[model samples]
Target chain A: MSLKPKTLVDFSFQALKANKLRSFLTMLGIIIGVASVILMIAIGQGAQAQVMSRVKALGSNVMMVLPGALGRFGAGSEGTAQSLTLEEASAVARLPYVANVAPVVRRAALVTHGANSWTTTITGTTPSITAISSTMSTVEGRFFSPADEKSAAPVAVLGQTVWQNLYPNGSDPVGTTITIKGVPFTVIGLLQSAGASMGGNNQDDFVYVPLKTAQIRLFGITFIGLMEVQAAGQKEVTPVINEVTALLHRLHGLPPGAPNDFTVRNLSQILSTAQDISGMLTLFLAGVAAISLIVGGIGIMNIMLVSVSERTREIGIRMAIGATQRDILNQFLTESIVLSLTGSFIGIVLGVGAAVAVSAFAHFPTPVSSLSIVAAVAFAIFVGVFFGYYPARRAANLNPADALSYE
Target chain B: MSAPLISCQELTKSYPLRGMEIKALNGVDLAIEDGEMTAIMGASGSGKSTLMNVIGCMDRPTGGRYLLDGVDVMSLTKDELAHLRNRKIGFVFQRYNLLPRMSALQNVLLPLVYAGVNAGRAANRALAALEMVGLAALAGNQPNQMSGGQQQRVSIARALINDPQVILADEPTGALDTVSSAEVMTILKELHQTRGVTLVIVTHEADIAAYCERMITMRDGRITGDSIIKGKRGA
Candidate 1:
């Protein structure tokens, strides 16, 4: 006589119900494993997404040329001898693929307005710096005009942080005088807040001044620090970088075999690299979590083995009552699968809830993907079937007489 | 006229223990007709249980042929033997063997479940079987909550659920008190008398054997005597 599917299910449920605590305890391993897997993946992906967004905000189709070679560890330290200059930046700006070039000179200095004082990085660049960074905008007054750079005017634009620090009452700083390194500079405009960028640097914690003013007036400097170059479009970035590299080598009169004194880095490449690293991190974490799932599977196998031995007499009784080997096998296998699936369901709920909670309270991004949920469920089933087979087969293969007479 | 309900020829069974073979059954030939109430009487190691197991198709003989309801039992596969047991033979164990977790009704319906009866009809038949044993009132009670006699009755109900031709009882009352034992025997006798089911009881007790119409005595894995009691007390 063949047992119906519903009857089989009922039998499994009854057996599991017989030892509720044991069943739940056995399921705990799976629940923890699945939840951790989902949580780890969410965290990993969230971090990747955060870094990607921050990198993308750096600007579209842009590259930064620094005064040193790209080191094995990271971006090289600036060379003692300045390798970038305003004339070379203009030459890059003349390239067919080049859209804009901003020669920058940066230094940290004390700025004071009234009794308020703040230490912030002072950036000296042409007005094209505004055109180079799409996210940069003057929220209030005007930016440095060409006349300001030519005249070496003592004028400055306050970043959001500098403005707020100098004027704690939220008063507008535009058209006010603020001293930079004891040199008086009139505030021309207040830039919009750009939040934090990659490397945890506050993008809005700087003061902007004209390049000539910074070079001749604030700190005597002959050569620029870096060049921020924007390409004509997305497709022109690679070509622009290569042309800039060749132009720099020729303009600097370096030998063909000599390593570049200046390093050219693509913003998009950095973005993709960050994505790849975070993606690997996500995979590695998920893999570690998957190991726990396997451990949980082993836990299932252990409990199922114990259950089979404990119920040997029951197996015998069922066999004597005309239960086929297949019937016994199916019954035990179904019990384990039900157990794991139940755990997986609970894990999904807990994992998703935890991700949402973390994102809400901890201010961490944790995006739960449906694909992860589906994959988690599928893996749980596979684990159940794979681990449960041995014990179930052992149950089915028992000698009815021996099992019946087993004490 | 037709073949006996159970037939065995030169039946032999042995087990290997510690590098030596121990014979449980030694070339026994036996047969029983339909509608017979028989008891196999023997001491602890006389192989009465082994014979009962082979006759019930729960085990295979080492060297012999067994036929149940005219079907060759020795040649059947494990699944086919299970199906045969489900359709042609029912078991009543000494401990009642009622799944302790289930209610009486559920226990009684177990055989019908194996028989692939639909839930509605299976339940009806199980209730009828339980009613036959006079435990219908306790149908919803678990075995642990019932008296030994009641649990044995539930097992009898389970055995009878599929309406098999034969019921094999292995010391069905061994775990019960005298009164409970008598109550269980009364139910068995009733089923045998009213339904004409062939009943085989394996027991070491002479009193329990006396309830059967025919008693077969065994010694040393071999049957020594077979006799019909002229006036069986209950039959």
Candidate 2:
């Protein structure tokens, strides 16, 4: 027996060369399935990475102390509520391991800059917030200072979006007054544009001001919403958290045996948990996409089996001309694999297109991973082998006499 | 003759239809020398096709010794038998089993493809075969685009491409018109006479069988008559 290729592309591109359209269509299923898998994972992973970096941007040592640890949706812990105050924020800052502390007080407020008025969110924070949260970058003007917080200054910092919207003209709005709920505050700084959250929320669409000023002027006084503490180093985070909890308990006048009313979260843990959530989300979506692959594989098998029956006489003729079972098997196997691989390649392109379109045009945080692309292509090929095999073997094993005699 | 190129002793083949064992061949013995053109003919269900399959090594005998050119076919492995078929035999089918997707040239080059002949040599040989059958100009056309006679000619070219020792034609002209059938028979006679290749054809028509020098007539599961006619039997 004669064997092996003497041609770059098999000169024996017999069936494929003949039924190009049929072959391409047959392969299309695998392509779509594979592309779906790759595109979904790539975009998913890309988004995951973006969210992860944003979470990490909170700083290596940043810790969040949330009041009233609530499980699931509603039902915040009553009586056990540990309300964080401006003093508590200072106490956390005073921890030996602490570097800077910022009190976060968030509220939805209507803002006005001349005739173009929009109801945007106002994030009440200390000046150190700009330095602590890695996710947000102040764009044009300087952020608030410590003196501004101590003096309870009525000055404000605008994110890129808010600055751009209120100042539609190409003019710097620093030192300009923008009223929040009829209260005038000077725009001392403009923040850098933060991209977007996975939920598609604009990270750079809020207004920032001194926490004390926000409380006294707008929301209320004394009790703060959350204490945003930044550790000097990652190693100091646990100690800082312990010290802050101790300080909160002492301030709350709670005796021993009561459940702690506050919860502290590190940046690393937050980043990992966010990644895990997105990873699980990717897997779930990919699993759904795999159903399409299975469907595609089944379609190939069905088509191939039909092809075998239709080409029974041809198989018989080949066998008569000295082609062995293995040779017949090889030919059919090659056809199926080519079909699946073709589909996989095309599908991957479509998937990537979909992902890129969603991210760039639709503004989503999508993660494109190399591993997902490779896996998708491999899986498409696998679908070909897995599904296309039985029909080929059946064709190879067909009785020559019976096949030849078949009309 | 040194050793008969084809030899068979007590060859038997049975078909299991439903619950019954239908004997397609029962204790058949035959021998064929090299450079012979033989035709086997019978009515439907007369076992002529079964004998053809057995002689072609497409099927194994239930009980018998089949020595093909001194190699015991029964002792040979499945792959070896297939190798023998590819290296030693060529085929022309009644239906002209050209792959519908391929051109006439590709159809002619099929046997050569399995033989692993490079396209250069394979194409040249395929062209030569097509030329021999006067189908050189129709090489690029698909089987469907051509006349039945042309497709059958392409099939003939396919059979001759590998330069096999034996060319087995099973009613090669069965699907062709009277003119095409005559043309196909004429080509078969020339190959046997000029190339000195052993040729075997299975047919139901006496006229088709008469194209060969020798005719073996079968009935049921036995050979009823075997004889050699002068020149070309049909002519």
Candidate 3:
């Protein structure tokens, strides 16, 4: 008997109505697949964003002096801790394109103001360091003046956390004093709370002191811990690092082409490398999630096969009632697609939910990309139609007489 | 000249059973005129059921010419046959094959829906058919809630919904009790008498065949008798 195309809709919708629970469960496969992809991409993207911001937080014109070469996840080393000394920092400041150089002497220290003591780090630097480095700024009160630096005055600048803890009642600490290891250092400034560093160090929990006072009264350092070379302009940063590297080699008495005593780190290179690595990592994660979607598509094919088997008699009846083979194919295919699309929609919602939850509780980066959602849904529908076609074709091609006899 | 509604010449239907062709119909030639209440009776495997399916457009003969309303229906495409089945034939199955999810009214309107009839007109037609079958009151009730006899009647009403040229019944009363079967046969006879619808019944029960104006008997896929039951026309 003849069959019209419209009858396909009727056949499948009726079949779905006949078994609502079974249809919904079939949809679950797509839902899980879609959710996995979205969640994976969101997490990978968030971690990528955090890394970028950390790299950006370092001043664009500043170059760090490190010792030896190391990969991105660098192997830990204690050799040549003073990669560039105070003399190298002074010479860089004297260079034609150099702006200001601050030799960084870092050490963990405990500070006390009225017995409210906090264990934090102290970064030793000259008073001009705030104007030369991206990581230094005065948020409240004043930074240490040149007069305080020349005299090697015992004055300190409090970080955001030290200020909050040592003065919880909001009293101004500019004229007051905080003691660092039984030595009295007047509070001279406060830092603008910088967030975590590229190396994952919390910048807000530390204090800054004059280079002379930190060396004389605290650690007694002549060679600075690390040298920061600030170029006069953004373009001069690379040349400044090169000039400083040359000066440092001469100071260390290292021969030409000898194993370097120090290393110069460019912020741009680090950022680009980080960006490339994170991009690859995101694709890797997304690929892992996509595996589940393939599994889901396979599930759709299996279910359709089982459904065709169970409805053989029904198909026979339809054929006898004047339905054509194409009509039968479309009916079963429509059912499979409906099931997959429903699952995809639910999974998208669940994925967004997981992203929000992770962002809130774990503070892990999770931002929903609209592109991923749309792709997942489209993929699910395609999987439905593509995989479902075979089983539907099998049903349609069956002989009506033979099918009617199927038990 | 008024054409016969169904005409078949040298009609044959065979099935491959265990590597041997089992002949269900063999070169049967016949003509069925309009507005006649007819019954075909036979023992099991006598081809009564097979002939019903072929004439009803549910199956095509392996080799024969079947002309319905002067159209070569046997050679038509599947979709065309479905259209003809919807337009020219209304079927009543022995098991009362009503979709379980639908109410009686919806069941009757099934064919009309595929016919693209508007919902309002389909409902009206469904109601009128149900009323004709004495089932108008149970329109909202599902098939499971109705008795076997009532379900069969609903199936009858459904067949009548599309206003087809013939009402085809295959052992329709075989599943019903005596009283219900009699009532169903009464409706079939009435439909033929009042609406001039051609009626065809496939049954083994002589009691049910007694209600038709003419009876044809078959044995081993061959017609053995054809006789008119006179005076039972309006009885």
Best by DockQ: 1
Q: Candidate 1, residues A176-246: lDDT per residue as tens digits?
A: 99999999999999998988777678989999999999988887987899999999999988899899999
Better model by lDDT, 1 or 3? 1
What DockQ number belongs to candidate 1? 0.65
lDDT of candidate 2 over A58-106, digit per residue (tens): 5658877778854575333322453777777777777787888877887
User: What is the lDDT for B87 in model 1?
Assistant: 85
Candidate 1 TM-score over all chains jointly: 0.85
Candidate 2's chain A scores what TM-score? 0.76
Q: TM-score of every model?
A: 0.85, 0.76, 0.73
**Higher-TM-score candidate among 1 and 3?**
1
Q: Compare candidates 1 and 2 on TM-score and give the better one.
A: 1
Supply the global lDDT for candidate 2.
0.80
lDDT winner, 1 or 2: 1
Report the error of model 3 at residue A296, Å: 3.0
Model 3 docking category: incorrect
> Which number leads on TM-score?
1
